[model samples]
Target: MMLTTNEDSQLALECERRIINAWPALSTLVLGDWVLRFANGYSGRANSATPLAYGAELDDAMLDMLEELYRADGLPPTIRLTPLVAEATRAAVLARGYRVKDASFGMIAPLAGLPVSEEAELQIEARPELEWIAGVAARQSGVKTHAGNLAAIVEKVRLPAAFASWLVEGEPVAFGMAVAERGMAEIGLICVDPAHRGKGLGRRIVAGLMGWAGAMDCHSAYLQVEQSNAIAISLYRSLGYRQLYAYETRILD
Candidate 1:
């Protein structure tokens, strides 16, 4: 079914909120309708600023204050240009010499008709265990250095969450996670072993998480993927997830 313009806008807004809630920051400061987040420099989504409302604008004074706050926290001045941000606000950040990076798509699919694989080997825990974190760190290099920070972030999640993994010969080969709130499931942390490529393990892993999401009464599920990742994009598209919005960060180092 096609979404009306207003329905699309509201869905994007809900996705933005669920994304922020699922992967929380250690601390957050609100300036107007923007949220300035910090998580000890773990990930851009956790440490940069985000707008909470559509068409939100930022003045020079507000930008300066946000920059100062980030610097005080030992982080670079960073702002995420999500769909909620105004074009003028984005232009202001670019004018201030904030370099763009990590362009990505926020995709979502309704859970009512989404298929979930009935793979018996997939394992899921309501709370992530140490092995799941270690498995993710082993597969994704970006998280290796931030393992402790990742643990800290996940521990702070108060919503209904699922940590999933697939083991081969008693060793983890794939991992994924899902957090459900307000009838929306924010699915992420999907990783599969390089040796297991082309086996559809990634899809199975996502299905495992979605299976859990459906059980939680989530109406829809969402995930973010870098635009450059064509393979991952194809995988998600094949599973009925469509781009709701795209976002990128502007950083001042």
Candidate 2:
């Protein structure tokens, strides 16, 4: 049996930290209060700012600092908030015209209940194959991951990770990644080809990642899935994943 030494929130936060740490940020300014991250206009998850150690003051000046940093990177200023954020900080961002984007649920589960499909065909790689990278990038709409950025992002993950691709007719149709750190495993980047949906491929890919994590002696697994993704939420719920918290990225347009 796997022991969960940390509380749900703590485990979720740790998983989130490790996942963000895997991103290949072009520039990052980590002050004592918050972290401002940028990746040359890559995905917002890499470029947007995030608040940390919640007790710090979040005033207009800090907002100015964020704007300056993002403007320098040639991107709009955005702040990503989580349940860990202070209520006043969230209100401050909302009071401004910051619209929420990609509000998602942070879900976690023990590896024991994770289900793997025998019919699903998934190929696992330490480094993302060229086809796998291209397949994933194609599925992304806004803030897409170009080939170079995709390569950099995958290569930046120093922890034990597996890039899994769902193959159909010897071509990748879906792609995702699993990274294990500090006894916790994080599964993310789960994307499916629009041409091929409702095939249970997502479940299989997640199962493959969870199995891999379990084999690595990881006690627990976690992932951030969009709240609006009903199919994904249902699938994860069926596989015994529970919501730990929800986070949203607010963009200054």
Candidate 3:
């Protein structure tokens, strides 16, 4: 569904809140009314600080506190940004090296026209099993062995969250989640078993989540996907999802 500028802003704000709500951080700081999140080592979304909701320039104290906090956690302070973030703030980040990460698009699809597949029927659980968590962890770099962290994340997921998985003969082969809030659903963290990549398992997983969202009275489904993921982007487009907004993450070493 096409959104007006006001509607787009509202949707983005809603999704932002839903994501933060569904996956809460271990701690948070309010620097000049900006959000600074810490979630140990789970993922960038939980650990990286962002210049959101705060309009003024960042002060030295804020940066120093961030450095101290993340350093204590054994991580270099990192910042994540969306298109609305100030370019000046980005230019100011000190880093030994930098790289583009999660160069992503916020995409959404109307629930009215989503297609369903028999394969989607394979997803029968609203909550993922431990095997499902491990399947997703094994597919992600640096996260496979951190079962404790992954389990914590799964535990933190709020209600109305849909955890979907594909199992073959009692073993999980794919995993994904749909977080719904305020009439919108965000389908995220969809990963398939390396051995099952050539099949339509990814599509089936996403279709199942979207179908679930529609059934729950959600008006639209959305997600954040790295722009470089051409295959996944193609799948979502084929499913009638369109880009709502784009965000980029600049990693500092």
Instruction: Evaluate all candidate structures by whole-model CA lDDT and list the values in order.
Output: 0.86, 0.77, 0.73
Name every residue pair that clashes in candidate 3: none
- Candidate 1 per-residue C-alpha lDDT over 1-253 given as tens digits, one digit per residue, 9 for 90 to 100: 1234898889988888777789999998989988889999888899999998888889999999999999999989999898799889988999999997779888988788555556668888889899888778777775345678888888889898999988887788999999999899988989888999789899898877877888788888899999999999999998779988888888997
Those runs of model 2 whose alpha carbons end farther than 4 Å from true positions after fitting are 1-6, 54-56, 113-120
- Per lDDT, what order, best first? 1, 2, 3
All candidates: CA RMSD (Å): 2.3, 3.8, 3.2
Number of the top lDDT candidate: 1
Q: What's the number of clashes in each of the models?
A: 0, 0, 0
Lowest lDDT block of 10, candidate 1: 137-146
Query: CA lDDT of 121 in candidate 3?
Result: 39
Candidate 1 vs candidate 3: the lDDT winner is: 1
Steric clash count of candidate 2: 0
**Tens digit per residue, CA lDDT, model 3, 3-120:** 4587786676666666776666777787764577777668877787765542334556766786787788787677666644555555555332446656778888899855444573
Q: Where is the poorest 10-residue window by lDDT in model 2?
A: 1-10
